[model samples]
Target: MNYNREDELKFRFNQFIISKVTGENKDYYSKLTIEDFVDIKNTLSNINNIITYKTTISFMDWLRDHFSYVDENYEVYLKDVLKVKPSVNGYDIMVTGKVNIVAEIKCNKPINNGFKYGSAQKNGIIKDIQGLLEGKTKVNFNPIHAYKFLVMYDFGEHSLKATEHLIKNIPSGYRGKVEIYNDKTQLKIDKVYVVFIK
Candidate 1:
Protein backbone atom coordinates (compact mmCIF):
# COMPACT_ATOMS: atom_id res chain seq x y z
CA MET A 1 0.00 0.00 0.00
CA ASN A 2 1.12 3.52 -0.75
CA TYR A 3 1.57 5.41 2.48
CA ASN A 4 0.55 9.09 2.53
CA ARG A 5 2.44 11.14 5.09
CA GLU A 6 -0.11 13.95 5.47
CA ASP A 7 -2.98 11.54 5.91
CA GLU A 8 -1.10 9.69 8.60
CA LEU A 9 -0.33 12.91 10.42
CA LYS A 10 -3.99 13.90 10.40
CA PHE A 11 -5.00 10.50 11.62
CA ARG A 12 -2.52 10.69 14.49
CA PHE A 13 -3.92 14.07 15.42
CA ASN A 14 -7.38 12.61 15.64
CA GLN A 15 -6.00 9.70 17.61
CA PHE A 16 -4.51 12.11 20.10
CA ILE A 17 -7.88 13.78 20.59
CA ILE A 18 -9.57 10.45 21.13
CA SER A 19 -7.03 9.42 23.73
CA LYS A 20 -7.41 12.73 25.58
CA VAL A 21 -11.19 12.63 25.53
CA THR A 22 -11.58 8.95 26.32
CA GLY A 23 -8.71 8.78 28.82
CA GLU A 24 -7.16 5.78 27.14
CA ASN A 25 -3.40 5.58 27.33
CA LYS A 26 -3.39 2.50 25.17
CA ASP A 27 -2.26 4.45 22.11
CA TYR A 28 1.42 3.83 21.57
CA TYR A 29 1.79 7.64 21.39
CA SER A 30 -0.12 8.34 24.56
CA LYS A 31 3.13 9.50 26.01
CA LEU A 32 3.31 12.38 23.55
CA THR A 33 0.79 15.08 22.77
CA ILE A 34 -0.88 15.15 19.38
CA GLU A 35 1.18 18.10 18.21
CA ASP A 36 4.36 16.44 19.32
CA PHE A 37 3.49 12.93 18.14
CA VAL A 38 2.46 13.69 14.58
CA ASP A 39 6.03 13.93 13.40
CA ILE A 40 6.96 10.57 14.88
CA LYS A 41 4.17 8.79 13.04
CA ASN A 42 4.85 10.63 9.83
CA THR A 43 8.52 9.75 9.97
CA LEU A 44 7.71 6.11 10.50
CA SER A 45 5.09 6.05 7.78
CA ASN A 46 7.79 6.84 5.25
CA ILE A 47 9.86 3.91 6.36
CA ASN A 48 8.98 1.04 4.04
CA ASN A 49 11.72 -1.50 4.62
CA ILE A 50 11.66 -1.42 8.38
CA ILE A 51 10.37 -4.97 8.40
CA THR A 52 12.56 -7.60 6.79
CA TYR A 53 13.09 -11.34 6.96
CA LYS A 54 16.58 -11.24 8.41
CA THR A 55 15.59 -8.63 10.99
CA THR A 56 12.47 -10.50 11.97
CA ILE A 57 14.38 -13.74 12.34
CA SER A 58 16.97 -11.97 14.40
CA PHE A 59 14.26 -10.51 16.60
CA MET A 60 12.77 -13.94 17.18
CA ASP A 61 16.17 -15.22 18.24
CA TRP A 62 16.53 -12.29 20.56
CA LEU A 63 13.12 -12.94 22.03
CA ARG A 64 14.03 -16.54 22.71
CA ASP A 65 17.24 -15.47 24.38
CA HIS A 66 15.87 -12.58 26.43
CA PHE A 67 13.22 -14.44 28.36
CA SER A 68 13.66 -17.36 30.74
CA TYR A 69 11.44 -20.41 31.23
CA VAL A 70 8.95 -20.24 34.03
CA ASP A 71 6.77 -22.63 36.09
CA GLU A 72 3.50 -21.07 34.93
CA ASN A 73 3.39 -22.75 31.55
CA TYR A 74 2.12 -25.64 29.49
CA GLU A 75 3.90 -28.71 28.20
CA VAL A 76 4.02 -27.37 24.68
CA TYR A 77 4.80 -23.74 25.44
CA LEU A 78 6.24 -21.65 28.21
CA LYS A 79 6.09 -17.82 28.31
CA ASP A 80 8.89 -16.34 30.33
CA VAL A 81 7.76 -12.83 29.56
CA LEU A 82 4.14 -12.39 28.70
CA LYS A 83 4.54 -8.82 27.48
CA VAL A 84 7.15 -6.29 26.37
CA LYS A 85 6.51 -2.74 27.40
CA PRO A 86 7.39 0.79 26.16
CA SER A 87 6.92 0.11 22.42
CA VAL A 88 4.77 -2.97 22.06
CA ASN A 89 3.38 -5.70 24.28
CA GLY A 90 1.86 -9.17 23.99
CA TYR A 91 3.94 -9.98 20.92
CA ASP A 92 6.29 -12.89 20.47
CA ILE A 93 8.96 -10.87 18.68
CA MET A 94 9.68 -7.17 18.26
CA VAL A 95 12.47 -5.87 16.06
CA THR A 96 13.52 -2.63 14.40
CA GLY A 97 14.97 -2.62 10.95
CA LYS A 98 14.53 0.44 8.74
CA VAL A 99 11.11 0.24 10.39
CA ASN A 100 9.75 -2.38 12.79
CA ILE A 101 7.95 -5.69 12.57
CA VAL A 102 6.12 -6.90 15.66
CA ALA A 103 5.17 -10.53 15.56
CA GLU A 104 3.12 -12.73 17.84
CA ILE A 105 3.69 -16.46 18.15
CA LYS A 106 1.24 -19.31 18.68
CA CYS A 107 1.17 -23.09 18.35
CA ASN A 108 -1.32 -25.89 17.73
CA LYS A 109 -1.63 -29.64 17.40
CA PRO A 110 -1.86 -31.01 13.89
CA ILE A 111 -4.50 -33.64 14.57
CA ASN A 112 -6.69 -32.53 17.44
CA ASN A 113 -6.79 -28.73 17.50
CA GLY A 114 -5.30 -28.28 14.04
CA PHE A 115 -3.49 -25.04 14.81
CA LYS A 116 -6.72 -23.15 15.33
CA TYR A 117 -5.81 -20.76 18.14
CA GLY A 118 -2.37 -20.39 16.67
CA SER A 119 -3.96 -18.95 13.55
CA ALA A 120 -6.26 -16.82 15.66
CA GLN A 121 -3.30 -15.31 17.44
CA LYS A 122 -1.80 -14.49 14.10
CA ASN A 123 -5.01 -12.78 13.10
CA GLY A 124 -5.11 -10.96 16.40
CA ILE A 125 -1.61 -9.72 15.81
CA ILE A 126 -2.67 -8.56 12.37
CA LYS A 127 -5.65 -6.79 13.82
CA ASP A 128 -3.41 -5.14 16.34
CA ILE A 129 -1.11 -4.11 13.53
CA GLN A 130 -4.07 -2.82 11.57
CA GLY A 131 -5.23 -0.77 14.51
CA LEU A 132 -1.86 0.86 14.82
CA LEU A 133 -1.73 1.45 11.11
CA GLU A 134 -5.14 3.12 11.12
CA GLY A 135 -4.04 5.50 13.83
CA LYS A 136 -6.47 3.99 16.31
CA THR A 137 -3.64 4.25 18.80
CA LYS A 138 -2.22 7.58 19.83
CA VAL A 139 1.04 6.53 18.21
CA ASN A 140 0.93 4.62 14.99
CA PHE A 141 2.90 1.37 15.05
CA ASN A 142 2.97 1.19 11.26
CA PRO A 143 1.42 -2.24 11.10
CA ILE A 144 1.33 -1.85 7.36
CA HIS A 145 5.10 -1.53 7.27
CA ALA A 146 5.59 -5.27 7.61
CA TYR A 147 4.35 -7.72 10.20
CA LYS A 148 3.68 -11.43 10.72
CA PHE A 149 2.33 -13.95 13.19
CA LEU A 150 4.08 -17.27 13.77
CA VAL A 151 1.96 -20.39 14.20
CA MET A 152 4.37 -23.15 15.17
CA TYR A 153 3.32 -26.70 15.96
CA ASP A 154 4.64 -30.24 15.75
CA PHE A 155 8.28 -31.08 16.45
CA GLY A 156 9.25 -33.81 14.02
CA GLU A 157 7.99 -34.86 10.60
CA HIS A 158 4.81 -32.99 11.30
CA SER A 159 6.86 -29.91 11.88
CA LEU A 160 8.42 -30.25 8.46
CA LYS A 161 5.01 -30.79 6.94
CA ALA A 162 3.63 -27.78 8.78
CA THR A 163 6.58 -25.70 7.63
CA GLU A 164 5.85 -26.79 4.10
CA HIS A 165 2.27 -25.64 4.56
CA LEU A 166 3.40 -22.26 5.85
CA ILE A 167 5.70 -21.83 2.90
CA LYS A 168 2.64 -22.10 0.71
CA ASN A 169 0.26 -19.90 2.67
CA ILE A 170 2.21 -16.76 3.52
CA PRO A 171 0.56 -13.87 1.74
CA SER A 172 2.45 -12.06 -1.00
CA GLY A 173 1.98 -8.76 0.79
CA TYR A 174 4.17 -9.89 3.67
CA ARG A 175 7.45 -8.02 3.16
CA GLY A 176 9.76 -10.44 4.97
CA LYS A 177 10.57 -14.10 4.51
CA VAL A 178 9.06 -16.97 6.50
CA GLU A 179 11.57 -19.15 8.29
CA ILE A 180 11.35 -22.67 9.72
CA TYR A 181 13.44 -24.06 12.55
CA ASN A 182 14.03 -27.77 12.22
CA ASP A 183 15.89 -30.07 14.65
CA LYS A 184 19.15 -28.14 14.54
CA THR A 185 18.84 -26.21 11.32
CA GLN A 186 16.96 -23.05 10.46
CA LEU A 187 15.76 -22.91 6.91
CA LYS A 188 14.43 -19.94 4.98
CA ILE A 189 11.37 -21.60 3.56
CA ASP A 190 9.80 -18.76 1.60
CA LYS A 191 7.62 -20.76 -0.78
CA VAL A 192 5.51 -23.01 1.49
CA TYR A 193 2.69 -21.76 3.69
CA VAL A 194 2.53 -24.59 6.17
CA VAL A 195 5.30 -24.67 8.66
CA PHE A 196 4.09 -25.41 12.20
CA ILE A 197 2.59 -22.00 12.96
CA LYS A 198 3.38 -21.69 16.63
Candidate 2:
Protein backbone atom coordinates (compact mmCIF):
# COMPACT_ATOMS: atom_id res chain seq x y z
CA MET A 1 0.00 0.00 0.00
CA ASN A 2 1.63 3.21 -1.30
CA TYR A 3 3.76 4.26 1.67
CA ASN A 4 5.98 7.16 2.49
CA ARG A 5 8.73 7.22 5.11
CA GLU A 6 6.34 8.37 7.85
CA ASP A 7 3.65 5.84 6.95
CA GLU A 8 6.21 3.06 6.81
CA LEU A 9 7.45 3.99 10.28
CA LYS A 10 3.93 4.11 11.72
CA PHE A 11 3.02 0.76 10.15
CA ARG A 12 6.13 -0.83 11.61
CA PHE A 13 5.36 0.63 15.06
CA ASN A 14 1.79 -0.65 14.89
CA GLN A 15 3.09 -4.07 13.99
CA PHE A 16 5.49 -3.97 16.92
CA ILE A 17 2.72 -3.11 19.37
CA ILE A 18 0.56 -5.99 18.13
CA SER A 19 3.49 -8.39 18.26
CA LYS A 20 4.81 -7.42 21.68
CA VAL A 21 1.45 -7.20 23.42
CA THR A 22 1.95 -11.01 23.85
CA GLY A 23 -1.77 -11.72 23.88
CA GLU A 24 -4.64 -9.34 23.16
CA ASN A 25 -3.71 -6.08 21.43
CA LYS A 26 -5.37 -3.30 23.38
CA ASP A 27 -4.31 -0.72 20.81
CA TYR A 28 -7.17 0.64 18.79
CA TYR A 29 -4.82 1.07 15.84
CA SER A 30 -5.41 -1.49 13.13
CA LYS A 31 -3.18 -2.53 10.23
CA LEU A 32 -4.34 0.47 8.29
CA THR A 33 -3.79 1.04 4.62
CA ILE A 34 -2.33 4.40 3.58
CA GLU A 35 -5.73 5.19 2.11
CA ASP A 36 -7.27 4.50 5.49
CA PHE A 37 -4.91 6.90 7.26
CA VAL A 38 -5.74 9.52 4.65
CA ASP A 39 -9.48 8.93 5.23
CA ILE A 40 -9.10 9.15 9.01
CA LYS A 41 -6.93 12.25 8.69
CA ASN A 42 -9.66 13.99 6.71
CA THR A 43 -11.97 13.62 9.65
CA LEU A 44 -9.91 15.44 12.27
CA SER A 45 -12.33 14.49 15.02
CA ASN A 46 -11.46 10.82 14.57
CA ILE A 47 -7.82 11.57 15.34
CA ASN A 48 -8.34 14.30 17.95
CA ASN A 49 -10.85 12.22 19.85
CA ILE A 50 -8.37 9.38 20.18
CA ILE A 51 -5.50 11.62 21.14
CA THR A 52 -7.56 13.53 23.68
CA TYR A 53 -8.90 10.36 25.24
CA LYS A 54 -5.48 8.75 25.44
CA THR A 55 -3.89 11.91 26.77
CA THR A 56 -6.50 12.20 29.50
CA ILE A 57 -5.97 8.61 30.55
CA SER A 58 -2.21 8.98 30.59
CA PHE A 59 -2.38 12.25 32.49
CA MET A 60 -4.72 10.76 35.05
CA ASP A 61 -2.34 7.85 35.56
CA TRP A 62 0.50 10.27 36.13
CA LEU A 63 -1.59 12.45 38.41
CA ARG A 64 -2.71 9.60 40.61
CA ASP A 65 0.95 8.89 41.14
CA HIS A 66 1.67 12.53 41.73
CA PHE A 67 -1.03 12.83 44.38
CA SER A 68 -0.33 9.35 45.78
CA TYR A 69 -3.13 9.60 48.28
CA VAL A 70 -5.19 6.45 48.87
CA ASP A 71 -7.92 8.49 50.49
CA GLU A 72 -11.31 8.18 48.76
CA ASN A 73 -12.07 11.73 49.88
CA TYR A 74 -9.52 12.87 47.35
CA GLU A 75 -12.46 12.61 44.96
CA VAL A 76 -14.85 14.44 47.26
CA TYR A 77 -12.21 16.93 48.31
CA LEU A 78 -11.45 17.57 44.66
CA LYS A 79 -15.01 18.64 44.00
CA ASP A 80 -15.61 20.40 47.29
CA VAL A 81 -12.56 22.50 46.55
CA LEU A 82 -13.86 23.36 43.13
CA LYS A 83 -17.45 23.79 44.34
CA VAL A 84 -18.52 22.64 40.87
CA LYS A 85 -18.01 19.79 38.49
CA PRO A 86 -15.44 20.02 35.73
CA SER A 87 -18.24 20.03 33.16
CA VAL A 88 -19.54 23.23 34.74
CA ASN A 89 -16.20 25.03 34.64
CA GLY A 90 -14.76 23.27 31.59
CA TYR A 91 -11.71 22.03 33.51
CA ASP A 92 -10.32 18.70 32.38
CA ILE A 93 -9.10 17.52 35.78
CA MET A 94 -9.06 18.67 39.38
CA VAL A 95 -7.70 17.13 42.54
CA THR A 96 -7.47 18.32 46.12
CA GLY A 97 -5.66 16.69 49.02
CA LYS A 98 -2.10 17.29 50.01
CA VAL A 99 -2.19 20.05 47.44
CA ASN A 100 -4.90 21.50 45.25
CA ILE A 101 -4.57 21.02 41.51
CA VAL A 102 -6.52 22.00 38.43
CA ALA A 103 -5.60 21.21 34.88
CA GLU A 104 -6.92 21.69 31.38
CA ILE A 105 -5.91 19.15 28.77
CA LYS A 106 -5.21 20.38 25.26
CA CYS A 107 -4.77 17.54 22.79
CA ASN A 108 -4.75 19.82 19.74
CA LYS A 109 -2.37 18.93 16.95
CA PRO A 110 -0.57 21.97 15.59
CA ILE A 111 -1.86 23.52 12.39
CA ASN A 112 0.15 25.07 9.51
CA ASN A 113 2.46 22.11 10.07
CA GLY A 114 3.88 23.89 13.10
CA PHE A 115 2.68 25.30 16.44
CA LYS A 116 0.52 28.14 15.19
CA TYR A 117 -2.93 27.91 16.71
CA GLY A 118 -6.15 28.20 14.77
CA SER A 119 -8.50 30.93 16.06
CA ALA A 120 -10.70 28.61 18.08
CA GLN A 121 -7.73 26.79 19.55
CA LYS A 122 -6.07 30.04 20.52
CA ASN A 123 -9.28 31.32 22.09
CA GLY A 124 -9.72 28.12 24.02
CA ILE A 125 -6.18 28.26 25.39
CA ILE A 126 -6.59 31.83 26.47
CA LYS A 127 -9.89 31.02 28.12
CA ASP A 128 -8.44 28.08 29.98
CA ILE A 129 -5.57 30.20 31.22
CA GLN A 130 -7.94 32.89 32.38
CA GLY A 131 -10.08 30.33 34.08
CA LEU A 132 -7.09 28.72 35.73
CA LEU A 133 -5.11 31.75 36.80
CA GLU A 134 -7.75 34.41 36.98
CA GLY A 135 -10.42 32.21 38.54
CA LYS A 136 -13.09 32.92 35.94
CA THR A 137 -16.10 31.07 37.28
CA LYS A 138 -19.42 31.34 39.03
CA VAL A 139 -18.24 28.99 41.79
CA ASN A 140 -16.53 30.18 44.99
CA PHE A 141 -13.36 28.31 44.13
CA ASN A 142 -10.17 30.27 44.53
CA PRO A 143 -7.62 28.88 42.12
CA ILE A 144 -4.80 31.08 43.30
CA HIS A 145 -3.31 28.41 45.58
CA ALA A 146 -3.91 25.41 43.31
CA TYR A 147 -1.37 24.11 40.86
CA LYS A 148 -2.82 25.43 37.64
CA PHE A 149 -1.87 23.59 34.52
CA LEU A 150 -2.38 23.73 30.79
CA VAL A 151 -1.32 20.24 29.79
CA MET A 152 -0.72 20.27 26.07
CA TYR A 153 -0.19 17.10 24.02
CA ASP A 154 2.91 17.29 21.92
CA PHE A 155 2.60 15.51 18.61
CA GLY A 156 6.14 15.20 17.26
CA GLU A 157 8.15 18.41 17.83
CA HIS A 158 5.35 20.91 18.25
CA SER A 159 5.77 21.52 21.99
CA LEU A 160 8.37 24.26 21.59
CA LYS A 161 5.87 26.21 19.55
CA ALA A 162 3.49 25.96 22.47
CA THR A 163 6.12 27.32 24.83
CA GLU A 164 6.93 30.13 22.46
CA HIS A 165 3.26 30.98 21.94
CA LEU A 166 2.58 31.06 25.67
CA ILE A 167 5.58 33.28 26.37
CA LYS A 168 4.56 35.74 23.70
CA ASN A 169 0.89 35.76 24.65
CA ILE A 170 0.71 35.31 28.39
CA PRO A 171 -2.36 37.18 29.51
CA SER A 172 -1.76 40.87 30.25
CA GLY A 173 -2.09 40.71 33.99
CA TYR A 174 0.47 37.95 34.29
CA ARG A 175 2.87 39.05 31.57
CA GLY A 176 5.20 41.13 33.66
CA LYS A 177 6.05 38.42 36.19
CA VAL A 178 5.65 35.20 34.20
CA GLU A 179 8.42 32.62 34.30
CA ILE A 180 8.86 29.79 31.77
CA TYR A 181 11.46 27.32 30.54
CA ASN A 182 13.59 28.19 33.50
CA ASP A 183 15.49 25.84 35.77
CA LYS A 184 12.30 25.77 37.77
CA THR A 185 10.05 22.82 37.02
CA GLN A 186 6.97 25.00 36.83
CA LEU A 187 5.75 28.31 35.48
CA LYS A 188 4.48 30.78 38.01
CA ILE A 189 3.28 34.22 38.92
CA ASP A 190 5.55 34.88 41.87
CA LYS A 191 5.93 31.74 44.04
CA VAL A 192 2.73 30.05 42.93
CA TYR A 193 3.41 27.24 40.46
CA VAL A 194 1.39 27.29 37.26
CA VAL A 195 2.64 24.17 35.59
CA PHE A 196 2.56 24.11 31.83
CA ILE A 197 2.86 20.44 30.99
CA LYS A 198 3.95 20.40 27.36
Which candidate number would show the highest TM-score if scored against the true structure?
2
Which digits, one per residue and each the tens of the lDDT, describe model 1 over residues 17-56?
6776666545444356777667777876744323322333
lDDT tens per residue, model 2, 75-120: 5644443453325554666665567777767776667777777777
Q: Model 2: residues >4 Å from true position, as ranges? A: 1-49, 70-88, 176-198
Clashing pairs in 2: none
RMSD of each: 17.0, 7.0
**CA displacement after TM-score superposition, residue 45 of candidate 1 (Å):** 40
Assess the local accuracy of residue 124 in candidate 1 as a C-alpha lDDT between 0 and 100. 49
lDDT for model 1 comes to 0.43
**lDDT of every predicted structure (CA atoms):** 0.43, 0.60
On lDDT, the leading prediction is 2
Q: TM-score of each candidate?
A: 0.31, 0.58
- The C-alpha local distance difference test score for the whole of candidate 2 amounts to 0.60
